[model samples]
Target: MTASFAAPRYIVDGGTEATSVLRRLARAGWTTREGFALPENTWDVSGTRLVLFGRVADADTAELAVLAAARGAGVVAIADAGSDVGRALYADLARVGPVSVDPDAPVAGESDEPASSGPQLAPEQRALLERLAGGETIAAAAAAEFLSLRTANRRIAEAREVLGVRTTREAVLAYLRIRRETREG
Candidate 1:
């Protein structure tokens, strides 16, 4: 008999959050990344067991919907702390499955924490970051990580939001700026 391994799961807050995570992972050299938004109806059928619901405005509602949709889906819910609702939501969702938060996550007015800080990384997020750090192409990163091109774009958007920048290029620059500052400090 052969055993099958399930993909890692995630539940990011929104499109922007998703993008930020993807970009960070790509730059960090992770591979085989896959994630999804926490859309109530559509995600259950997204095929992958691991799903990411990026930057949900209403954590309570999103949590309930995720719990409902994940009934038989076995999806892991990941939250971005940039949204105030995330803390409470993480606690509640943790009862059902693994729940994680990103303190450096960019919502609107998130803290000054590093994007790498906060809760443990979900399986998918960890893999994505590894490949990104390894210098994988955005498309290759997405494909190697099992994510769709659309989802890859969303992840890039998330990175931009975290850096308070509008585009991936800018976000990359911002990340570099921090690295340089740290090195010279």
Candidate 2:
């Protein structure tokens, strides 16, 4: 006999780093979707989870935390270790007892090459490489996607691995080559 588990669902917001992290997590066995707005009063929270990669300006974090607690869903928030808001939210949610905070943790992993002779990229990975080609620093490219510096670096490293290159510059060249071939195909 075999046992099966349902994929954990996630409602997330932030920038590219957040989406990239979420995609990796999903590939590792979680179900995810982008949810920028607060859940409606009638929205069901029975079987889903929420992750806030950065501060949200429009939603009340405290209330959302409480609601998630009441519904027995877990909530995770990522924030800068030095930010007052991050500390306050962590303390407050600690009191609520169902929230976890990871301050300044790095998120991202290396991309691996496919077994075939040629390299391919997911759309997001291609976009990141494109940004790099356009002269954006890794940090800047990540910021444009709302990803943390660490996460961005990880994605770049992964890109290098996927392209079978050893350096960031090589990764960029490989990406360009792939893009050109794709276009000319």
- Per-residue lDDT tens digits for candidate 1, residues 1-185, read 01132222335655565566555443433232233234465533324333333334475566654564344233334455455666555444533333334523332112345444323333333344446556776788789865777666565655555556786556555655655565676
Top of the candidates by TM-score: 2
lDDT of 1 at 55: 39
Q: Model 2 over residues 110-176: C-alpha lDDT tens digits? A: 2443233475454346667899999998888988866678766776777788788899999999988
Q: TM-score for model 1?
A: 0.33
lDDT score of model 2?
0.52
lDDT of each candidate versus the true structure: 0.47, 0.52
User: If candidate 2 were superposed on the true structure by all CA atoms, what would the RMSD be?
Assistant: 13.0
Instruction: Tell me the lDDT of model 2 at 168.
Output: 94
Q: Which regions of candidate 2 deviate over 4 angstroms?
A: 1-117
